[model samples]
Target chain A: MGQTNNDERTPTLLDDMFSVANKRDQAALARLFDHFVPRIRAFCLTAQPGSNLMADDIAQEVLIRIWNKAHTYNPESASLNTWVFTIARNARIDYLRKNGRYQTGIDPDFLWADDEDENADPFREAQQKRDQDTIRASLKQLPSDQRQVLAKVYLEGKTHKETSEELNIPLGTIKSRVRLALNKLTVIIRR
Target chain B: MIRYHPSIELLTEYSSGSLSLAKAVAVSAHLEHCKECRTQAHKLELVGAELFSDPAIPTSDQQLNQLKTNLLSKITNGEIESSFDKYGQAAPSVRMSKLQSGRPLSSESKYQIPKSLRQLIPSFYDDLKWMSLSPAVKIATLSNEKDGTQVALTRIKAGAFIPSHTHTGDEFTLVLEGAFSDESGVYKKGDFISRDARHKHKPVVTKDAECICLTVTEAPIEFTGWFTRLLNPILRKHHPSTS
Candidate 1:
């Protein structure tokens, strides 16, 4: 896979930017950085205890990744957002790992290959993503506490214990939050 | 650590994004072959997305676009995504089917029992006579052996109260429907409440909906009170193996 290092757009345009980036579209790259940079910097700035100067550096690094790997974008396989968030999730994990705060990495084999088995048919992946989209829409109905637990544990890569500590709640509470979140989520998604 | 079926919990976590990439990939592969967990995972994923929008963030259309761009660029080509064969989901054979058939009583006519649970019975468990516990509950005498161990499906009415009793042996309850409440707490669909000999309580299904649970037990219930004790013999005669 190719690699690039460019900086110009903001983070808000991430999804669109990725679609264009996948096509090796340079104009979209410009729009991409212009939209995402500030937010990325802000996120890094707030998330880290002592890091405002390096926020720009991290944000720049994240953008370069977008530019070089655009060809690998597979809309039929994964949504632009899921793909991006996955990237961000990994990057955040990488940052934490370097700081000894987290341990996670994306595998080289899993990201690019589309698993297009002739016998299995690859189109099912698209259908799966669509089904997931509907389920995600339903999860939006849950109350905030359950939502937050899911976000921190699932999205932010925090452990239940870590989440408990971070949220200043009990361990059992985390389990129940997850359970309730999932239960309510299942009900909504099935509909 | 709490022993949970990796596919079930990991799929739940993957859909929620709680699982690591290394792990989620494996779970994804398991999902490829296992339809039950895949459906559940998809449902969980939908729930995660639903929760995302619930938070009222002040992201203007412009900011939202920026966030998306930043995310896309991060993983465009950093590393090769792992293949399913190399790092497939870690699903022990024991838990896979127990985890898969989450429905109370599967509507699917062909009941393919997992090897782990299947090993418990002789060849004839499948052929056992199944009877209704109530409108919701169904019971089957898997073993007519002297020990009297059997497997049954208890489909409780939405608001039904299971006579509070104590288990004489290991009692495994896997939820197939709405939710159930015991002295412990409420258990929703897909939640597996496995109580060893130590647990004893009355399970009451909430008014929200009925609960159907697939329960496996070594011995029959020790009915708590005088009336319940009197009813025990009647219950015993109804079971194929006990009778």
Candidate 2:
């Protein structure tokens, strides 16, 4: 139903969606929404706990943003999934910042241009797929203690202090676990 | 030149969408000026994105199509800007208290404000209306910040001294130009200064040049000594900022 699945990271469908949206192709956008919305909704729910309403709100915002910022998507720079999920991450941050409190808004220079490797590999998608597989594998390799700390802090939106209190562990130990986990993850991602 | 920067924790919070808008604004401004922090923030956001895209999270079908409807309405109505055209979404409200009472007195000096600031408020010195809080300090207020927060631009003349004061809540000061010194340390352009109730110090402008700063406070100042405390009421009277 999607791109060549030699690697799931191939953004073939995403590429078509963005190019079509750039041309104001409504049908293409509708297709994109039907395919991606469920995934984004699920992702948002996992990222933020106990806020199904907030998760839905974030999914809506992510779609609107993707529709509006379609031209900004550089396929050469990142996979479409990474780009869409990036917007979801920022929207979640906005949800946490505002926290049911509405205000006008703030300046939006949040995204930065990352240095994409120009290694002339024809199989960029396959490479990215491999990278994704490696990243998830690395996630599994993390000690349960470290993964637990990260899941609480990054996914559940708990401060280290709250997580410490919840686990009845010292805050310093929790911080150390997160640090070690980040180092291990970075080494794996770079590999 | 950005010797001072927000901690990684703050940057992570900024990326996670959990920071208050005031803090978000300050972080945004700093990220615009500092490339290091910008890269750090991007990496952190990527990590968050990776965490979310694991494909194992559970989702619902309820109200799935409603989002598409909302988006289609905006796209069809010409409310949103297309890639071929520019979109300028005016903030719904700018009825800030300080905007009505007074405009800060901007100097004829040629210090250019950060270009990114124009996104939040007007930046040209002529357009800027700075109201003098003291002989040397002026504050140009911006939005009607919700949650009792105050967002404003402050300009301090060279060698002028800001009064020693503590805050009712968190105070964030980002140096946009020049430098200043308090009991804490010296701050230059791109330095993000944060203080709370436990910290009290008077920031004096560096001898070389006047300093321009963007300050967001959760509440108004509580002047420490008798003199500035007496001035506090007048400060509040003339400059009715939420912070």
Candidate 3:
């Protein structure tokens, strides 16, 4: 991915990630902490409102996971934000599964295991960057209703059914809105 | 090649981590074989990340410092060190090798369990406590969710026929081994077939090989045949819904 002049933080985070992975640098870990912990906390709080303890616990867990799994991060396969977002997402699911109403024996780690292809090539890397940029740019143009559904699913951790119930819209409408939004983002190309 | 795939809605929910664990298990198994769905799910994850990196909620400077201090102190005190050591020692590769070494030598040894299910099935499918639902059909319960969903594996003898049945709720079946044909179509390994209460059909395994499927049911299925109808109570009792 080309480093645009305005997006300096990407390279910095990439460097910090490498340092943490290769050298076990606590300073780099601290930098990562400052960058990701707040975002992770916000992500968790969006799912469980008024539960700062839950948010804090999940944030810490994600950071610790980043520390532990830093070496597995591959910039070519996914952006650092994407990598960390998944970690945060899985951490939230695990936290809920353990302590919240959604108790289950199923382990999130195996379900969402990092299965990125090991055979990375420059062509694949460019394609990934293009896809990432398209998604980021098109996401801004999605209509408010469509964007709302995406937010509910991705940010608030609501299933389509829950989103429908919470928004007082029909479940079919929720599914269609998600479909339309994903189509606009070109995230789900029909085969 | 895999034919039937999870719907876009299911893929989106699975990618966003909004789908329940039992349902996600079915999707994960399909992705293990269907590269197309895997690509779609990966793209969906990119969307999640883009939204995830939106402007933060702005924690207070004091709270941020306190959190960072707490984390650093734990790191400094070598608490994370001990945990890291434990993780490194018990790495998944090592455990996987250990499990492989313990598998019994047999013809079925070539059957590779899907990675998503290895957590529940340590080595082999034969190791599970398969209970006979009929002479030709046996099922081993894998997990029962608190929401009354049932995840299990159904093993059918070669050329065997499963009695016509209808679902009480949504049922997701991922073909794990061999192939089975129902009124809808033939489903082979990696094919994900989702059936709801409206569908009632019998499935027959291909004569060449026995069929094994990973099934996740939101509610127990009901058999339509009079003799098999008697089996509904047994199915319900085993399912978390009735009990």
lDDT of each: 0.51, 0.65, 0.84
Q: For candidate 1, write residues B74-132 as lDDT tens digits.
A: 44544323112221122234434544557244343233433223333223233445565
Evaluation by DockQ, superior candidate among 2 and 3:
3
Supply the TM-score for candidate 2.
0.70
lDDT of 2 by residue, B1-243 (tens): 777888666676666554556667788789878878765665565555566665554333557666678766776466765221212233222323334556563463255445446555543544677788788888887754656677788899898988888877777899988899988799999999888767778889999888889988767777888777887776565433533
TM-score of chain B of each: 0.45, 0.76, 0.89
Q: How does residue A114 of candidate 1 score in lDDT?
A: 23
- Evaluate model 1: give its lDDT: 0.51
TM-score of 1: 0.43
The recovered share of true contacts, given per candidate in order, is 0.14, 0.23, 0.65
Docking class of 3: medium
Candidate 3 or 1, higher lDDT: 3
Worst 10-residue lDDT window for candidate 1 chain B reads B82-91
Per-residue lDDT tens digits for candidate 1, residues A1-191, read 01111111123355555656656665676665554455455445445646754564555555665565555555555544444444443455445545544233333223212222222335755565556554555455768898788767654556666688998999789878887766654533332
Residues A64-178 of candidate 2 have per-residue lDDT tens digits of 6666667766665566666776666556655654664436455343322222333324476555555555555677789899988777766665666667898999978977787
